[model samples]
Target: MRDLKDIELFLLDMDGTFYLGNKLLPGSIEFVDTLRKQGKNFMFLTNNSSNDSESYAEKLRKMGLDGKIEVFTSGDATGIFLKERYGTLRIFLVGTKKLAKTFEKYGHKIVQEDPEIVVLGYDTEINYEKLAKACIYLRKNLLYVATHPDINCPSLEGPLPDAGSYIALIEKSTGRLPDYIVGKPNPLMLEMVMKKTGVSREKIAMVGDRLYTDIEFARRSGILSILVLTGETTLEDLRNSSIKPDIVVENIGELAKLLQKESGE
Candidate 1:
C-alpha cells in the first residue's frame, strides 16, 4: 500500500466525498486546509459535467469553503481529449448550457446538425429533442464520446440520470456505445492531473465515495484509494464488491486524522 505521508496530490470527488449539495462534509474544509498547511496539493475532481469548474468553485465559496483550490471536471478532461484528437470536427453535444459553453470555450464548435462527433454529458436540462437527436446521431454511428460512465448522479432529492444512463438509452435504441468514455476509472483524467502537477502516481491519491469510479480510478491509475462512507456506499457494499479501497474511513474527518498521523503531525 502507498503511504499517506508520501501523497502529494489528493484527487477528490465533490458530491459525496467532499460535500453533499450545499453542505460541506465534516472536516472537508479542514482536510483541504491541512493539505495546504502540509505543503501537499489537492484538486477537486468530479464526474458530474452538469456545471463548469467555476460554478462548483463558486458553490464552494458560498458554502464558506473559499480558497485558491482548483477544480477539474470530466467535462474538462473530455474537452482536452477532443481538442487534442478531433479539434477540427464540428461536434453535437447533449448537455446543459453550461457544459456546451465550456466545450465552446475549449475551442470545439457546437453545431446543430451535420456534426462529425457527438459528445454526451450529464445533461440536467435534457429534453426529448436532445435525446432524439442523440439517438439519431448514434444511429448514424458517428464518433461518440461521453464525459463519464456514472450511471446516476447523487442529488439531494434522489439519484439523477447521468451520461451513462443516456448511453444506455442510446445503446438500446441504436446498438452503439461510446467510442470512448473519458472520465474516472479510465485513468485519462488522472493522467492529465499528473501532467499538470508533475506528480507521480505513487505520490497522488484519490479520495471518493463510489467504488467503481473512485476506487477503480486509483486501481487503474496505480494510485492509492481512500473510500469514505459518507456517500452512497455502505460497509456491506464494500464487502460484497470486488473493487477494494486501499483505505477506508467514515468521512473526511477521519481521513484528516489519518493524514495527520501519517505525516507525524
Candidate 2:
C-alpha cells in the first residue's frame, strides 16, 4: 500500500465518509480542514444520481460544510461518458426528472419511446408504470446502462432502495442487465475524478465505509483506500472481506489524528 503522504487528492464518499444524513461524522470537518491546511485537495463523490451537484452542494451547506457546485456524482460521470461514446443518442431514462435534465444538458436526446439506450439511476419517484415501460423497452432490445449498482442508499432513516435495486428488478424481469454500469468500482468514475482534479490514479485516495463500492474501487483503480468503521460496515465485515483497504480507522477523527501525528503537528 502507498503511504497516505503521497496522496494528492482525496475522493470522499458522501453518505459514509462525510455525513450520514443530517449529521456530520465526527472529525469530518476537521479532516477537511487539516487537508486544506496542508494544501491537499478533496471532493465529495457519490453514486447517488437522484439529485444534481447543486442539490448536493446545498445539502452540504445545510450540513455546515463549505462546498461548490462542481461536486461529483455518478450521474454526472455517466452522462459525460455516454455523451462521449454515444453522442446524440435517444435515451429512455429511469431516474428522477433532474437526472433526465442532466442527460439533456449533455446534449443527449431524451425520449420516452423507442430509445437507443435505457439509463437507470436512483429514482426516488419511481412508479410501477415507469418500471413496466423500462422492462418493455429492454425486452424490445434497447441497450441498457446503470449509473451505479448500489442496492441501498444510506440515510438518516436507514437504508433505502437505490438504483441497483431497481436494476436488479428490471434485469430479473427481462433476463438482461445493463451493458455498462458507470459508477464506483468502475474505472470510468475514477477517470472522471482524475480528469476533473488533474490528479493521477497513483496520487489519489478513496475513503469510505463500504468495501465493495469504495475499497474495491480503489483496489481496481490502483489508488489508496481508507475504510472508516463509522458507517455501514463493521470491523468484523472488514476482517472477512476479500477487498481490503490500505488503512482502516474508527472514523474520520482518528484518521485526522493519524495525519497530524505523521506530520508531527
Candidate 3:
C-alpha cells in the first residue's frame, strides 16, 4: 500500500486479469486510462508465448485498448536472451509463427537437423514431427530452452496444456530439462522489461492473477506486486500460497482507484 506512490510503471497480465476469452474484463480500460492520467506507465507483460506482440496489440485494439501501448511476451523475452547469449547458434525452435518470427527478427537461424540449441515456446501448432525432433535433439544433448514454465493456460473451456507440459514430456523422454527457462518467475522477463522501459526495479509494480508466475516474478525481481481476484486466483488461492502480493484487489479497477488516492490524483 505504501509502495503505490513509488510505482512509476505497472506490468499487467492480460488473459485472466484483463480479459477472458474474447471479452475484456470490467474496468480494465478505465484502469489503464486512470493510470495514464496519473502520469504512471503500464505494460502488458504476458507469459503467453503463443502469440507475438503485434497480434496482442490487435487483440487489445479490438477490446478498445490503445494500439500504441507496448505489450511484452515470453517469446519477446526469449528473443532478447538469445540475441545476447547465443545469437549465432543454429536453433531448432518449436513454437508458433510468432515465436519463429521473434527469433528470425533477432537474426537467429532456425534449423531442424541437429541444432546447437532447441528453443521451445507455446506451439499451438505442435505436431508429432516437431515434438519427436525436439526429443531427438534432447537425446543428442543439445541445449534446451523454454519460453516459460507454465503448466496450463486458462481457456473458456478449461485449462490447456502449456509449455511446461511439453517440457515435462521431453524431460521424461530424454531425462533432460531446459538449460534455461527465459520468462516470468525467472527474473529474465523483468530484466527485459527493465531494459525496454528504462525503469528501475523499485519503480515497477507487477500486477497479475497468477501466484507462481506473476507474483513470483515480482518477488524474485524485487518489484512490487498486486494480485487481482478477477482471474484464475481466488481469495482461497491467496491464503494457501507462500508468495504474498503487496496488494490484493477484486479487479484492476479497484487498484486504479487506490493508486489514484495514493498518488493524489
Best-fitting candidate, measured by lDDT?
Answer: 1
Candidate 2 RMSD to the real structure: 1.4
* Root-mean-square deviation (CA) per prediction: 1.1, 1.4, 1.2
lDDT per residue (tens digit) for residues 141-161 in model 1: 799999999999998999987
Candidate 3 error regions (>4 Å): none
Please give, for residues 1-265, the per-residue lDDT of candidate 3 as tens digits: 5378878898999999999989888889888888888888989999899898889989989878873578999988888888887666788988997888877777887887758899999889999999998888888888889999999999999999999999999888889999999988999999988888799998999899999999999999988889999888999989999999988999988987897887776
Model 1: what TM-score?
0.97
Q: Which window of ten consecutive residues has the lowest lDDT sum in model 2?
A: 62-71
Could you tell me every candidate's TM-score relative to the true structure?
0.97, 0.96, 0.97
Model 2 stretches astray by more than 4 angstroms: 67-70
The better-scoring model by TM-score among 1 and 2 is 1
Model 2 clashing residue pairs (backbone): none
Give candidate 3's total backbone clashes: 0
Q: What is the RMSD of candidate 1?
A: 1.1
Residue 48, model 3: Cα distance from true site in angstroms: 0.8
Q: Which wins on lDDT, candidate 2 or candidate 3?
A: 3
